[model samples]
Target: MVQQRTADRDGTQQKANHTPWLEWVASGIGLLLTLGIFGSIGWQAFDDAGAPPAIAVDVTRVVPVEGGYRVEFRARNSTGSTASQVEIEGKLAGDGAEAEIGHVVFDYIPGHSERKGGMFFTREPRQESLALRALGFADP
Candidate 1:
């Protein structure tokens, strides 16, 4: 009976040693996966760091509203960084004369995204030469 108890004790000791090895392997794999995920994210951020902010303005539509003409436009940001305080200026010209001026401001424009806004002008923009330009932007 004593020999049988000793054999059982040896088996239990072996199982205890093997269980820790499995636990260590699992912990190592989890740590490696975590590090790999973070490393890839950091690499992508560094890769996009050099891209400059490029903001563009496109007038989509112009409709006459109650008080003025609503100039629907799209603002596109083709950069890696976010832009803040984005301002767009619009001018309506007819026969070499500026008829009206309007402007719109966007609070935030994220990188690789587009935002829509409108400007109001007293004159009908369809009859005149409408010029839309990006005034300025600040880094967010």
Candidate 2:
């Protein structure tokens, strides 16, 4: 009986001393994966924040709305910086004279993105030669 008790004690000691190699490996792998995910997110944010600012405006279409003519346009940001208070001006000319002028403002436009807006003109913009210009932009 005493020999049996001693054997059981030795067995318990051996189990307690066993190394959890698999658990350690799994924990390390989990930590690495977490770091990789956070690193990718941080890199993307850094890349976008450091971009410069370039703006382009294109007059796509001019259609007459109920009250006035709506000038459909697209604004594109090619630089790495965000633009705020983007002002676009439109001029309509007929018979070599400026018929009407209109302007639109965009609240915010991020870098490498495009936004659509419109300007209202009291005159028929389709009948006149349309001139679209990006007046200016403020840093966001």
Candidate 3:
């Protein structure tokens, strides 16, 4: 126990209140931190609210799998918007034949990030005109 004592004029030692101002300082800091966090969240919510998701799909690699060929693709979200349920399609057309189409869906493609997926195709992707495209995406 810490107590501060003072002697009176009549030679009497009395106890004095000796409380530091730590609570006030801690409360002030907590309030400021709460306000700062809310401000940052508000800024981020409004900053990219209208920004569209510029999701692009690029074919990275192709390899022969069990049943057919596997085409690995990279889905890149260039804008500040996150994309969900991103649907990507790959088409192979060549030699006056019908185009073979394969598609895959990604769960999420975060803002300014990339996600990888693969699709299966019966035809050889390297020998044909391989085109990769992001069909559509849902806002996350």
TM-score of each model, in listed order? 0.65, 0.62, 0.63
> 16-126 in candidate 1: lDDT tens per residue?
777567888999999999999999879869877567678999889888899878999999998777888998898888666657888789998887789999888887787
In model 2, the clashing pairs are 51-80, 52-80
Q: On a 0 to 1 TM-score scale, where does candidate 1 land against the true structure?
A: 0.65
Q: Per-residue lDDT tens digits of candidate 2, residues 97-125?
A: 65788778889888788899888877776
Q: What's model 1's lDDT at 17?
A: 70
lDDT string, candidate 3, 2-120, tens digits: 23333342234222344347977999899999999999879878776568899888788889998889988898998878889988888898678998888788899888799988888
For each candidate, the alpha-carbon lDDT, in order, equals: 0.85, 0.83, 0.82
Kindly report which residue stretches of model 3 are placed more than 4 angstroms away from their true locations once superposed.
1-49
Off by over 4 Å in 2: 1-42, 45-51, 126-128
Find the 10 residues in a row with the least total lDDT in model 2.
Answer: 121-130
Winner on lDDT (1 vs 3): 1
